[model samples]
Target chain A: MGRRIAQIICFAFGALLFALYFSQHPTARSLNTAVMIDYWQIIFAITLLVGVISFVRINLSNIRRGDNRPYRIISLVGLAVMPILAIIWGIKGNSPFMWMFEYVQVPMQSTVFALLAFFVASASFRGFRARSAPAAVLLTAALLTLTSRSSLEGIVPQFITEAADWVRGNPSMAARRAILIGIGLGSLTTSLRVILGIERTWLGSDK
Target chain B: MDWGVIIAGLLTLAIFSFLYRDNPAYKMAESLLIGVSIGYFLVITWTNTLMDLLFVPLTQDAKWPLIIPLALGVMMFGRFHKRTAPLSRIPIAVLIGSGAGVAIPAMLEARTLRQISATVGPLVTESGLPDISLIAVLVGVLTTLVYFYFSREHKGALGGAAKVGTYFLMSFFGTTFGYTVMSRMSTLIGRVEFLLSDFLRLTQ
Candidate 1:
């Protein structure tokens, strides 16, 4: 009875919300969803506690085992302190949460991304070599767009920019539309799998 | 010069250290990032999807109508248990039925018809100087489609078409690579700005 109840609730709600999302009504569909999403944002906020607990357990155990003492200590402290300060002071305005997010997390994520630029340069120099006929045409189109986008327009003439406009507007847009159609079909299929319970693997390891 | 900048710089070094050797610092940062993300999302889904989709609607809107589906979702959880789990079938079947209903039309329309329609356009172009764009599209559609045609040896007419298709592929790759490079460069620029403006007592 309980199990049946859960499944019914999941489907009915999923369907209703899905329909509501598509509907024109601002209140019955959109606003209700926005409110629910806001309420559910609590879970991620609360996950900070779960993260700290798990980190402390793992790092403390690592230290006790004399394995990775120094790095473990760093994780242990960072996990413990930042959230406590943020929670006590509140996250908005001039709080520790806002400070740590802006300074630390934001920079780290950005720096990691910055490093990806080096990878792209290396890949372009090495991986983009045309071993076939079709590859050559693709390379030509790619080079046009790349030069157009980059700061190289000052050195290269205006003709390249015109060619890029032709490629992007007509051929590329057509391909993109075709790809979007495929993606839409793919997503619809996946949603169906989940709804039918054919894709219950998301429920986790058991069934 | 500031302590905060020093630490961030070190963190950068620690992370980038993987280029040479597998350092403990890099591993720690990577693992923490993964663990935190996973834990965070699990909590998020429980609240966002489960609570909102399964709980609130049943409570606030329809009462008994929700009971059957809720029972199905519960049966899903039963897979975790050893017995009585066969009860999961009723919900699972209904889900499959509904899924097929929703997907069949969408897949047929979007994937089959619309996709084909997008490829189907005039052989000529408005600019019309040999219509390289049209030629490119025609060749791309023919050869790339032929690249899949696999029944015959790719030597004569089809082989030549597929050969031009290679140029199409290369240009596609090159564009993707360039965009990726620009995106990364922007990230690097942002980080540098943060370090310069926020951490250091320097330029705003």
Candidate 2:
């Protein structure tokens, strides 16, 4: 019974929004934007709260079980302190919250992202092995591209760069468009499925 | 002797230490990052989204229609209770449905229609010679589409075309991977620069 009602709401809202996008009517457009910008924003914000609560609950349970208790405590403290600092001192540029964010979060994030460079190098070593004909082509193309786009361009011939550009302009672009068109068609089909209530995976199980 | 820069430098080093092996410093730094990120998100979302968008407008402007979505949002918490878990589907459905609804038409216009038009252009050059690049692009697009087409068995000519298409696809992916490596290297370079110039003060 509840599932039926949920399906109806999904269909109604989905169809309304889908139709709303195509409508040239000012009222429909404004209403769609209002629903998205205002209502959906709040819903997504509320979902974040849900996420935080789940995080805290899981960490607290972990702490209780003595699974990495010290680390869990640090995580909890970090979580607790920032909001209190934000509320009490406010998040002015000089506030403790902002200070922690700037000094801690930014550096950590940048360093983590920087680690991807090492991983990519390792992956490329494995990927550009030229184990087969197709792989040889891939390896050759990748090597040419990397050399052309790198500081080694001075050493590499200008023709290498020109060939790389040609590859990017024609083959790469065509493949990209084909993939894009596939995605567009797939998305449209999925949207129709959702509207028609044929797709119920989002509902989870009755369990 | 700014404390912030010193702390930033230490955290940066601690995070990079994971490249050697996972240690207490890296774990602590990782946990601190996760917690701080969530905390920061919560505060920002509360202020910029909830208070400014929902609460303020409702309280000050008396925009009562906002309550419908608010109620739906609140209903998402029903998942916390076993019996009421099914009720959470209402919000989930609304979110997925609306998201898909909004995406489809825009995707059609941008990815499908625009792409087709972009591909279908004048094959002749300004000097009246047939543009080889344009012809190559047209052939590439059609053959690649054929490569993805599962309806027919690739036995003869279709197999030959699909084989060529596979090379084009491989070239595309290889270039993309190469570009990714360059960008990632750039990111690493930025961190190195920060460490040297700002943290260690080794260079200007």
Candidate 3:
């Protein structure tokens, strides 16, 4: 009895909403879907508060278990202070929330980015190995690209410019277009899944 | 001397102190940052999205249309419970069924059919050999597709084609690596510039 009702409701609502999007005529189906999308967003907003509660609960439990976690307390303090300050003052161009964003978020992101240098160095070392004919060609192109002393020399030797331009225009363009095509397909598939609700893995469950 | 710059400058120094060695100040800043981000997302969703989009409209008018997603969203919370979790299928089925229905035509047109059509054009023209760029594109498309073909072992003609694919992949990866390195260097430079230009102002 329970599952029958669930299936009936699910199929009817899903089909109606899906069809609404394709309809040329003004219909209740389209209007209902538009409203439902907005309401779903509100439910997601409530989940944010739930997330904060979860965070505090987990960290507090960790501290209680003799973890000696002072950093968790620091987190709670910032969480408490910033929201209160923002609520009191309200966020605008020069408000405290904006202040925290510019000062805090940007710096931390930059720090994580600094680690990329080390990773790139190691990856490049592996990539530049002249182990095969293709590797040799890669090494030569990379050397030319790396060593080029901008203005006058390329003008002096037409062939150098022509060769460099050829490498950039042909092989590089092809490679990049291939990448773009793959990305476009992947994104299109993802968007399709989202709109259809077929890809509910993002919801962390069947729902 | 400005208070905005001073607080930011101090925070930057505290955060970056990890470069020398990890310590209390860095840990404190990092924790505060994580906590603030959680709070910020919550507040943004409440004010910018929820209050504007859902809460006001639902209350002002009896938004019966919203009842479906609201029910679906509630069903999603069922996963938290042990026994009632199977009830989550209602929402999941709705999501999957609708999502697939909408995406089917779009994906067919945009990704599969468009790509197949793109490959069907003339390979060689009267102007000369087919456009060199087009030839490289065809090679890349053919080779990469072949590279992903796992059914047959790379031997004989397959081996030669696979070899070309491997080279294309490596060169593609190599160029990507260079671009990533340059971008990372720029990030570091930008951070240092921010510290000097926005925070300190003494370097100028």
lDDT by candidate, in order shown? 0.58, 0.87, 0.65
Write one digit per residue (lDDT tens) for candidate 3, span B175-204. 555456667777767767878988878587
- TM-score of model number 3: 0.77
Residue-level error in angstroms, candidate 3, position B177: 2.3
Tens digits of lDDT, candidate 3, A1-207: 445545554456556655666676766655644635564465566555656777888889877885748998878877876678689888778887877777676677676576466566767787668888888767755544443434344454667656655666556545554555565566566655555445445434333
- TM-score of each model, paired residue for residue: 0.64, 0.95, 0.77
lDDT score at residue B49, model 1, on the 0-100 scale: 61
Ranking according to lDDT, highest score first? 2, 3, 1
Per-residue alpha-carbon lDDT of candidate 1 for residues B1-204, written as tens digits (9 for 90 to 100): 565566666566555566666777777665544433343334445555656765677687764444544554554554434786555554444444344444555566766577667666676666765666666565555555554456788898878866655445455555665567777877777666766776564886
Among all windows of 10 consecutive residues in model 1 chain B, the one with the lowest summed lDDT is: B35-44
Worst 10 residues of 1 chain A by lDDT: A39-48
Q: Per-residue lDDT for B159 in model 1?
A: 88
RMSD of each: 6.6, 1.7, 4.8
- Count of clashing residue pairs in every prediction: 38, 0, 6
Q: What level of docking quality does candidate 3 show?
A: acceptable
Which parts of model 3 are misplaced by more than 4 Å?
A1-47, A122-128, A133-207, B14-23, B83-97
Docking level of model 1: incorrect
Candidate 1 residue-wise lDDT, A31-78, digit = tens: 434423432243233333344455667778898999767766665555
Off by over 4 Å in 2: A153-155
| DockQ (Cα-based) for each candidate | 0.21, 0.74, 0.40
